[model samples]
Target: MITLLLSSHAQRIWGERIAVAVPPGTLSFLTAEEALAAEGPSAADIAFMTREVTGKSSPSHPTPELRGFDAVVEKSPNLKWLQIHPAGAERPIYRQLRARGVKVTTASGATAVTVAHSTLGAVIAINRRFPLLADAQRRHAWEPRLAERSPRDLAGQCAVIVGMGPIGRNIASLLGMLGMRTIGVRRTAEPVEPCERVVAYEQLHEVLPQADWLILCCPASPVTRGIANAAAFAAMPEGAHLINVARGEIAVEQDVIAVLQSGKLAGAYLDVFEREPLDAASPLWDLPNVLVSPHTASHSLGQNEAIFGIFLDNLARFRAGQALRNDVDNLG
Candidate 1:
């Protein structure tokens, strides 16, 4: 029997689904709540660290209780596999889990459409001057940006998308539907669909001058951390907008603020941040040119079921002794 370990939050909502997926008598459950109890399951072969944290969880912030369960898992000498929700696994907990010989798989592709849709919306809103319009609405003032200061057509404008992962590709495909051009950057420069061409990370600066919009959807790898800094922003065409749906460490917060202040970037939409629940006193909150979301760009009605599906599918594969999908055990 495959002994499964999971969160009480997850098991409560998904207990029936889990039972249906795994054959009767083939699986047993030990909730995280029970695992944390003085007398818990002595050993677990698999862990499903799921959460219902829509607005409460940020990619940078794991649920407090869930994060604490790592110790319980480590002591389970038989644990061989685990599943996580976040697309990126840069968090230290993941590293620690991997080091303990657990095969960590993630729900990376689940958020693609939702994240891309929100990112594209941010682009359109900023282009249409929604922030200024919102402020005007609050003051009951009549102010229209027409003629001289009117927004230009998005067609023919270039976008430099970092990462080229599921999220980046979806954003590129949507941008193509809008008649926009796209350039992708990642480990290799090979061309991907929708994007006219692709460039290696080493060539990022070479393509920045063409960007009307710079979207970050890359992983938080060593090469990606803090890649968007002052020097990088200066290479962009003036008035370029930055939309970061990727990890926050990829963009230096202070440096981003500096460029925004200097008008090097026309605006920015940041979902993930270097810090979760971004400091209330942080200028990002008050910046007229910035749009901040509490890492909720990926939140949607179907997201929970989507992630659960990945887990169930992988659970079937695990039961069959086959390789798992979205496995990042060997990844950095």
Candidate 2:
């Protein structure tokens, strides 16, 4: 019989459907709380994680509930697979689990559309100078000074997009509608849709000077951690803008601060930071050329339901010994 470990909330919400998918007497269940309290390693063969325990957590800070979940998974002596929620495999715990030979599946493409749209929104907001206009309105001033600080046209400009995953690809497609040229960057250099050309990650600097805008849409990983450092900023064309919708680890915050201070970059729209709740005295708050967000780029409706469907489908495939849709390797 297949033994499954899950969160208490998952059992309450989808226990019946899970049971319906599997034949009676063919599977047994153990909740995360039960696993943690077990005498020895909870002999669970599969662990199903949802947003309940995975949501609202970051690398710098994990919620108590999230820590507990990680502890349970780590202690599972027989855990062969983990059906985790959307894009959560970036966690260090998951890397450890993968090193231990446990299979990890995710609902990666579930939030692609939502995040892609949000990223496009950030690009547009910065392109049209919404932050500057908002500041002008705050003073009740009619400062549409065309000669000074005039917004440039997006058409005929270049965009260098890093990490061309589902979200990145979608962002490129949207950018194309605005008549902007796109260059995609990823592990592989193969050409993709809506991009003039694709380059390997190592060639990042080769194309930085050509970018009018640089967008970070990659998942946080060993290769991507601190990928955007001071040297990267130095390579970009003067007055280039930046948009980071990915995790904060992808860019060095201190280096980002330095570049903004030096006016090496025209402006930056950041949704993630190296530290969560960004310290009160952070220079990012006072940077006139930066737009900061609370890392809510993918906060859209119906995402949870979509991820749930991917998990359920994968569960049925697991029972049938079929290939899972979003089975993962090393998360990134």
Candidate 3:
């Protein structure tokens, strides 16, 4: 029987569905403890892991020895696939698994719908001054005139969406449905949904100034780290709203702070941060013009189940000798 080791979070969904999906495989939930107990290489045929398990658990970072219960697939003769739960596979374990000849897949488009909706809400909230309205409510004061003070209409606005991946394309679709002019930027400038114009990365500077809204949806890779800086922000039109649903490291936090302070940008809505669990004393919390969420914009109901469904489908493909869906092809 093929052995499947499932992490706790994936246990409820993938573990349950995979049982029905892979009847020949023996599915077992391995706690961090059970995983480490094996004498030699992994006794299992396949392991489904979340990036959190690979990085957060003890003996973090999968090694050749399969030490600390974190199984190294290709390193061990018995294991074959190392399926990761998150869309981004820039972690160390991914490389280790690939080098060892183990196949890797990801849940790339699972969170697209929810993440796109959240991005839309963030864009609208920042443009409409939702924070100011909430503050007005806290004071128990009527401020009908405040809405007039900052009137930014979503319709007719030009949004430049960066990345044009699943999340970016979804954001563009939503923005388009709202009657906004959608622009997309990709590495190769391919056609994407709801985008009237798709431009290459080289044209970013030219497009930045024309955008009334800038949405960041790119993954935080080595190529995109700190891609948004002082010059990029300066290139945007004064009073433009910035929405970041992408990795915080993509933007220079200091540069964003400077722009907001100078009134060059109308506002910003940030879901991710360079430093997670944003420190209690951080000034970002007090920035009146900025709206911050604790990286929760993409979280929604049934996320675990959705992630599992993808895993189950991919697992079937693995056994059938077919190309797996959402396979990570970073090396290429």
Maximum-TM-score candidate: 1
Candidate 1 structure quality by residue, lDDT tens digits, 117-154 = 99999989988889878988999999889897798789
lDDT of 2 by residue, 257-282 (tens): 88888888888989899989788999
Mind sharing the TM-score for model 3? 0.88
lDDT at 293, model 1: 93
What is the alpha-carbon lDDT of model 2 when measured against the actual structure?
0.85
TM-score of each: 0.95, 0.93, 0.88
lDDT of each: 0.86, 0.85, 0.74
Q: Which pairs clash in the backbone of model 3?
A: 35-69, 36-69
Model 3, 71-95: lDDT tens digits are 4343356667867767766657677
Model 1 ranges with Cα > 4 A deviation: 39-41, 53-63, 330-332
Which regions in candidate 3 have their CA more than 4 angstroms from the true location? Answer: 12-14, 25-32, 50-77, 146-148, 330-332
